[model samples]
Target: MTLLADRHGRTFPYLRLSLTEACNYRCSYCLPDGWRADGGPRFLDADEVRRLVSAFAGLGMWKIRLTGGEPSLRKDLTAIIATVAATPGVRKIALTTNGCRLSRHLPRWRAAGLTALNVSLDSLDRERFRAITGRDRHDDVLAGVDQALAMGFDAVKLNAVLLRGINDDELPRWLDWLRDRPLALRFIELMRTGDNGEYFERHHLGADVIEDRLRAAGWTPCPRAPDAGPAREYSHPDYAGRIGLIAPYSKDFCVGCNRLRVTARGDLRLCLFGDFGVPLRPLLREDGQRDELMQRIRALLGHKAAGHFLHEGKTGITPHLASVGG
Candidate 1:
């Protein structure tokens, strides 16, 4: 089997597939106003998804993460998960959501073949969570996370966008929670997109703060998994849970890039912040085009850049995190 390698020598074993661009939360840094733009009222159907995953799986991709504005919003998500799980060579099926409906739908999702999960939980403090995500469902989300831990998933991660004064001060609460819980919590550095420049300037906190604190407190770096996300994970002897930092602004941040993204509309985004997308939706329309689908994806690797240009303040065409499944 052929491995998905780019010109820069980075091999991709993971794929972040956006199922839809419809989110219910109005997160401060992400969709402050909720989803407002393109990429869809019409997302790729289950059959197209099956074909897409089959193509990727045949090319050495084993991990497929279903992401979205909020992936749970899709009613057919279970079918999508099952389709991916049934694909040959696909070993892991994961999903990232806002967690509003996690408790209501998790068991069904797990049974449908979801192997891992990530929930967008910006804060543990209810009011702060409401302030950040514009949703008063923190309690519900936390309960769902607790339930997820109870279920024996291969991995369960919590994602929080690191904001300067907003949720940055809430790490103590997370650390306290993580001391006993076995979940993996990751703090992602706020990224600049087509929009949110002013907000990014106001709330973009360096991820080094969390890293420094973790290092000082004696959290040892954990070996990265072959299909791990971009986060640098660390563990402490005293805590059952682990902490990870996804600092996109840090020097050489993209050097460890291992995953590629595809929008809900079926456009393949080589870089999350890539200025352009090579449309793959047309190729996904038919099973007979699997070779062409893989060919288009494979050929694009030769043009993949060494790294993203976020350091220069170029946010690319991404108007919001939800739009591209961030």
Candidate 2:
């Protein structure tokens, strides 16, 4: 069996699958005006998703994360979760969302075998959150996080886009909140996408902003796991939660890239900021095509680039993070 290893000796043990391109929040850093019509094909159906995960599972991919503008918009989301969970080699099932509907659907989602969660929570202040997301669901999102904490998930991560002149100074508020919650809070440095260049320039805060504060406040670096996401985590004895920084601009950020992303339309992205995507949906129609599907993916891995060129102002075809499951 061929492991999903690239030419650089980097292997992918995790996959991020986009279920839908639809999202509710118009996040300032992402879908500021909400999800727009991209005129692309419809998202993968349940059966297509099953075949997709099955092929990846056979290639030693153990972790599958369902991402989207918001995954809950799909009516068959529970079915999607069950399908991924049932795949033989897949060990973890996770989802990343804006958390507006988390509490409403969490009980069923967990019952369907979902294990971990990542919620986009850009602000701690109610009004600020509303301003950033263009929705008044701050209380709803926090309530969902609280419920997820009590539900015995493997882990629940809170993601905040570090924006200058916005939520950048809320680290103290986050630390105070994390003091008692057993959550993993991540501060992701804002990245430049195709349509958000001007916005990115204005709001993009260096992750060092948080790293410096974490160090000054006595947060020590924590060892990373083999299949962990691109987060440099830190912990402190007094705090119950952990803090992480997902800074793509960092010198060595892509050294531990262990995952691949599939867009909602079934296009495989080698690098989030890669210049091209290979369409995989054509081979995902039947179980009998598993061999060809895996082979196609294995061959493409050899072409995977060492890293992204966001520093050069080239964001590929990614108009927004939601489109490619970012």
Candidate 3:
């Protein structure tokens, strides 16, 4: 089995799988106002996902994250989790959800061997949350968070997209909430992609802004978790868990990127902000092609550009962020 290493010798061990392209929340960032009319998305079947995960896990891939418009929307999500959890080389199985449907399936997911979770929660205020997500289920998301904690998910991460005039004011409240809660909170900068071009232009808050806010709030920088993304991790004087800031647009971490994204339809995206991808479905379906898949994956890893050019004036000739990996 060959380990996939990039041109810079960065080991490619993390795989982020977009289980489905459909999502419940019509967030203005990734998708436009009416995405269905623009174009329909192709979702992968459970068997195909299992096969791909098995092959990659065999090729030195260890960490797997199930993402989606909202991964929990998949009816067979638990089964998928079980398959990947049972894979030979897989050591960690996690999910990134919108938290709208987490409460109902927390037990099932934990039972299926999910070790950690990353839930998207931009605002604490109900109306604001609804306005941002275009859904009126903020309470349900909060309830789901509590249910996940009760279900004993080891690491419960809250991903907050830091919008300048929108959710920026709520940062302190989120930090205060994390002071007692055991969950790790992450503040992510807005990226320029999909229908978010204008939104990102207007509300792209960087790490410096967040660091200043944390400093004013008397918070200090802390060590980042080993497997966490490029978030500038931090902690308050007496907080239980930690806070992280993912500044992809303002401060790119592609130099330390150890992960790659595989779209639901078998497209291998070397970088999250990459415009192009190599299709692996055809090769995967061919007879006696496991070695071929590894070769293609290695080739794609070598082609992994320096970084994703998703900032202003950058273009990714591929699908939206939702279709790639949210």
Ranking by lDDT: 2, 1, 3
Residue runs of model 3 more than 4 Å from their true location after superposition: 1-3, 32-34, 37-41, 216-218, 286-288
* Clash pairs (backbone) in predicted model 2: none
Q: In candidate 2, residue 42 scores what lDDT?
A: 85
Model number with the top TM-score: 2
Between candidates 1 and 3, the one scoring higher on lDDT is 1
The C-alpha lDDT values of all candidates are: 0.90, 0.92, 0.79
TM-score of each: 0.98, 0.98, 0.93
Model 3, 71: alpha-carbon shift in Å? Answer: 1.4
Candidate 1 local lDDT, 30-125, one digit each (tens): 888887655444788888889899999988999999999888888899888888988999999999988988889999999999999998888888
Model 1 regions more than 4 Å off: 37-41
Best by lDDT: 2
Clashing pairs in 3: none
For residue 47, give model 1's deviation from the true position in Å.
1.2
Task: Report the C-alpha displacement of residue 37, candidate 3, in angstroms.
Answer: 7.1
Write one digit per residue (lDDT tens) for candidate 2, span 85-190. 8889989999998999998999999999999999999999999999999999999999999999999999899999899998888888899999999999999999
Global lDDT for candidate 3?
0.79
